[model samples]
Target: MSSKVYTTESGEVVYAMVAEFETPADVYHAAEKVRDAGYSRWDVHTPFPIHGMEDAMGVKRTILPMVIGVVGLSCAGLGFLMQWWMSGVDYPLMTQGKPFATWQAFVPITFELGILFSAFTAIIGMLFFNRLPQWYHPLLKKDRFLRVSDDRFMICIEAGDANFDPDRTRALLEGAGGKHIDLVEE
Candidate 1:
């Protein structure tokens, strides 16, 4: 078995049908309609995260929250362990002659570390899963695509997937009332 090698300067190009819409509402509706048609490898770009657009695209909520939960729990456990080892077992410091393993002192650090771990987990998981921190992408080269960061809403359907057929995808976008029909090439 061999893994495909892609050392090229660009990501594998995706063939897309481009559309230009006069309003954000148009692209939002187009996204919903396109999802209903069942092209799984598609994406929508907008100047902002439009309301209800995620549901329209059939995108499920991310699992990163669950990951954060687990991290938080682990952090709590570890924090307790650290306090136990340092104050109870290792050093056994008798502060004001108070009893060891007092909950009063442990509470703040435990809570702080738990929240810290969860935050770190959420951020790292989001970046890893989304393949972010990336410096470049071919689509960023498209002339009008920059509008997606501002006032434009656009959707893209990737080519080369198992279900992708260039002509058919183009027709579907057209029927969905999409405008422009541009391809992202390497």
Candidate 2:
């Protein structure tokens, strides 16, 4: 198989080789092989989630929860402080003879701010980690991959991978039972 390389207008090399599989199991095994082969910049796509596929792909647990927790707690503290400063120091409004810094009155806004911060952190963190807002991908150019949303399963080894070698990678996928292999260019 010939590996085609293309240089972009900015003179950047961008391309990926995609291997199509007949079933989810085939793609799962292919992902295992790719992971064992030490390829980091590779991904597997399937119409639906496959059991054990995450382990096969060597995917690690995401840190999004931790990020959200930190941000949420920080925002909650800030919200409480803002309310405290406004009521106790800045304005000092006496409402029905209530205390200047009312903890009860601050709970709702603090909780809301915490939830809001957590939600925003979850969305933005996920997008940042997953590299979202990408309007195009090289794999989208492959005709066979169009079935990825339907019935086909695919594994793509990106050119940006440190261990990516077109010939060796293709051979590895073939050995792992991949079929209908195609090269995608950008």
Candidate 3:
């Protein structure tokens, strides 16, 4: 079978093979087949999250929680230190006959800062991990793929994958019950 190729404005010949499935189950099964075939650079898109689809796509758990945990703790500690330095050493204001570095008074601000840092870290880390803020993608040009937001399911295997072969990948997708297979250009 001849693979469709598209030349970009930059004169690059890179292309992506997209297989459209009629149902989420078909896409999920196709993802499993693609994963088992040792193709690492592939993605599944659906109208909504499918049950067990992550395992089918061989996606692993992310480390964003660890990042958030470290950032939050650091911010909380910094907040406590700032409060201590300001009240105990910088200005050394004495209030209600109490010691300047009162741990009790620092608790509220420290907790609030910790929460704020965690929330920020979570949002930033998610965007970073997911590679968001992408205004355009090659798949957006495919007319059939527009239904992915409503009902269609799709799996795209990039040409850059180490194990990618246009004919073999197309056959795999076909065996997995994919329809409307098309080549996407970058």
Candidate 4:
């Protein structure tokens, strides 16, 4: 296979090596190959979700759950503290001989704050972790990649991967039954 020389204006860099596959099954198997080859910074894109794709790609569990848990508890604690300081310390109020600092009155607010913070944390955390607001991508410049949102499946091995080698990566993709393997630039 002839290596396609991709030239761009000064400072333009190769972003990734993309491979096109016809079906989800092909992409799934190709992902397994790429994973076994020990290449990190790779991704598979499909028109629709495929079961077991995460496992095939060797994706680890995310820590967003732990982050949300901590944020939720902290907000709940703050809610309780705020209520106690206001009713008990700042301004003492007694009605019907009831104590000024009542834990029961704080339950609803505390629970609500916990739920609210947790939900916000989940949204913000997911966006932060996924690196959202990406206005542009090198792959978007490829006309063939447009099929990715419709019927084609693709696997991209980023040039930043430690195991990445232009020739070897292209060969690997071809061996995995990938067609029209192209080098994307940034």
Specify the poorest-scoring 10-residue window by lDDT in model 2: 1-10
Best by lDDT: 4
| Candidates sorted by lDDT, best first | 4, 3, 2, 1
- Selected candidate, larger TM-score, 1 vs 3: 3
* lDDT per residue (tens digit) for residues 128-159 in model 1: 88999887976788898888887777888766
Task: List where candidate 4 sits over 4 angstroms from the true fold.
Answer: 1-12
State the local distance difference test value for candidate 1: 0.77
Q: Which runs in model 1 stand beyond 4 Å of their true positions?
A: 1-15
* Cα lDDT tens digits for candidate 4, 107-167: 9999999999999999999999999878798888999999999999999998877778888
TM-score of 1: 0.87
> What are the models' TM-scores?
0.87, 0.86, 0.90, 0.88
Clashing residue pairs, backbone N/CA/C < 3 A, model 2: none
Tens digits of per-residue lDDT, candidate 3, 1-186, equal 225454555776656888899887778888999999998888999998899998998999889999999999999999999999999999999789999899999999999999999999999999999998787988898899899999999999988787777678889989988898878877
CA lDDT, every model vs. true structure: 0.77, 0.85, 0.88, 0.90
lDDT per residue (tens digit) for residues 1-186 in model 2: 225554545775658778889987778877888999998878998999899888998999889999999999999999999999999999999989999999999999999999999999999999999899787977776788889999999888887777777678789989999887766766
Order the candidate numbers by TM-score, best to worst.
3, 4, 1, 2
